[model samples]
Target: MAAKSATKSVEQGRNLRPFYANHTPEQLKEALRRMWLVRRFEEMAEESYIRGLTHGTMHLSIGQEASAVGICLELTDKDYITSTHRGHGHCIGKGAEVKYMFAEFFGKEEGYCRGRGGSMHIADPATGNLGANGIVGGGLPLATGAALAIKKRGSKDVAVCFFGDGANNEGAFHESLNIAAVWKLPVIYVCENNQYGMSVSTERSTAVKDVATRAAAYNMPGVIVDGNSIADVNEAMTAAMERARNGEGPTLIECKTYRTRGHSRSDRNRYRSKEEIESWKGKDPIPAFEDELMALGILTQADVEGVRAGVEKDIQDGFDFATKGTNPEPSSLLRGVYTTGDAA
Candidate 1:
């Protein structure tokens, strides 16, 4: 009787473990650090834009850090990802250095695109980041193509596509998902539904209550997760990635999140109420994750402070690097415009 009781207790404990228990303590700590980094980086970027230190507009993912970090935590360096306009968090989560990103934003010659592509077009091939697209639904087809290439090459790598909810209504979204499902291609489509596309709320634009329901038309699994919870996002992503890697075609995951900032720097934010913004602020991913880590004994208050301090230093250094870097010259404008080498 005692043996059976002990067995039941162990089973209960196993069932009670958090969704993120599969990850090591080190990985959890690193995730927390990256979340903080994403939050701080966007804050600094907004400051720089306000001070006229950077040109062009940028879409800041100030409140949607967990979705980015959680999804990328399940990916490897060999895996591919296509990003959207609001993709700074995705890039940082995929192992991009802040200094180079700053360089790109500042239009310095040492940037990822040699100062050609600004905030909306940052890409790092070394990290398997194809590029961030300025157009809505632009990355959907690209991710599908990349997944097709991986399938043909017989590689196990999968492609993850990050797009906003606005893209869901686009024709490309349907086409990409249909083809991906038909071919059994290894692609994961993640929709960061921040409730609004520009000034239009999802309620006003979307026909359905939840975007994930559309996945049924393509005959794929559709999932919904709280984008503010890193563990929840990670759990969903882990399952989706596993299915993709196992040659089970695509999965559509809609992360129901919110963006604290306006659509862009120029946005007046007249469409939403201040109360709504404050309510989402109370659900901020960073503080919630920090509390979770502390409860699990993976981190303490001092450790959290240390992480914040280190991230601050990194952001400052990146800003200094960008400010001190050289700008691009006009003479090299047409250098990479046309292909010069043989196709063969």
Candidate 2:
């Protein structure tokens, strides 16, 4: 039987090469490794939350690894990205340290926010992650304002704002898009349409089936791609980033995927059925990619196991770092809050 990777794009016939044909073996390996890291990270986070290791309610992006990796891999570290509440994958994909992420989860002083912000407020400026927002559509204005600043400074840097399908309905989304469009700001609005928004399915709440359609109102390109297909998402992102960097304006990419976990710790998932969840589970991007790699002779069984072991070591190291790190001291809690004349 022919390998699936031997297949060509729908537009092209068998004459064209496979999707991974253009990518080096090393690149494919890293892609699979990165996706594995995200899956393991989310699973570990959920376990930590249940074990009372992480504070506050936790939102796990368990099934959405491909979407995050695909888009963020297209950008440079100098470019900025604003993230949503379920932003661990975004944060990690954008180059945030897993150790720091674990620190944040454990409320350690070494965390991105010194443990003050917790899960939703994770941000690392060094890596160009503006921050993750706890509020719905909260990061939209922040990302837009950052794009405005980049434009004002005449920098080629771009800003990517990651939001869910639910955030598209928010007022900030419309206002920010309008302003960004008027000025031709360098920003990419990525809507992670994972079927449901905290138990409220998009079919019932959204006006249009495709959230990309909303981009037309702002006079920009609106593209939709399979969120499960990393290559497809990357293709769309490459186009959007080109538009943003050329000062043409923003592009909204609608990535259709599913969130494997509940909305939060309190979620019972009474809204959805087991059959539907299992259907998505069967399409898990990580395993699918793995099988593709093996089928294409790009990865051996030993190579795959080595990657998994390496990822586990990294996760364990992060756990150890968080466990050994000092907790936030109450005395120094307010030190960074108020800016002093000499501090800046």
* lDDT (tens digit, per residue) of candidate 1 on 1-344: 00012222212333435444566656777788899988998999999999999878999998899999999887777889999999999998988888889999999987887788888999998878998999999999999999999999999888999999999999999999999999999999999999999999999999998999999999999999999999888888878888898999999999999999999988998999999999999999999999988876667899999999999999999989988989877877786777784221
Pairs of residues clashing in candidate 1: none
Residue 291 CA displacement from its true place in model 2, Å:
2.2
Q: For candidate 2, lDDT tens digit of each residue in 77-171?
A: 77889999999989877867788888988999898888888899999998789889989999999999989999999988889999999999899
User: What local lDDT score does residue 112 receive in model 2, on the 0 to 100 scale?
Assistant: 89
Q: Estimate each model's TM-score.
A: 0.94, 0.91
Sliding window of 10 residues with minimal summed lDDT for model 1: 1-10
Misplaced by over 4 Å in model 2 are 1-23, 341-344
Error of 2 at 207 (Å): 1.1
Deviation of model 2 at 128, angstroms = 0.1
RMSD of 2: 4.7
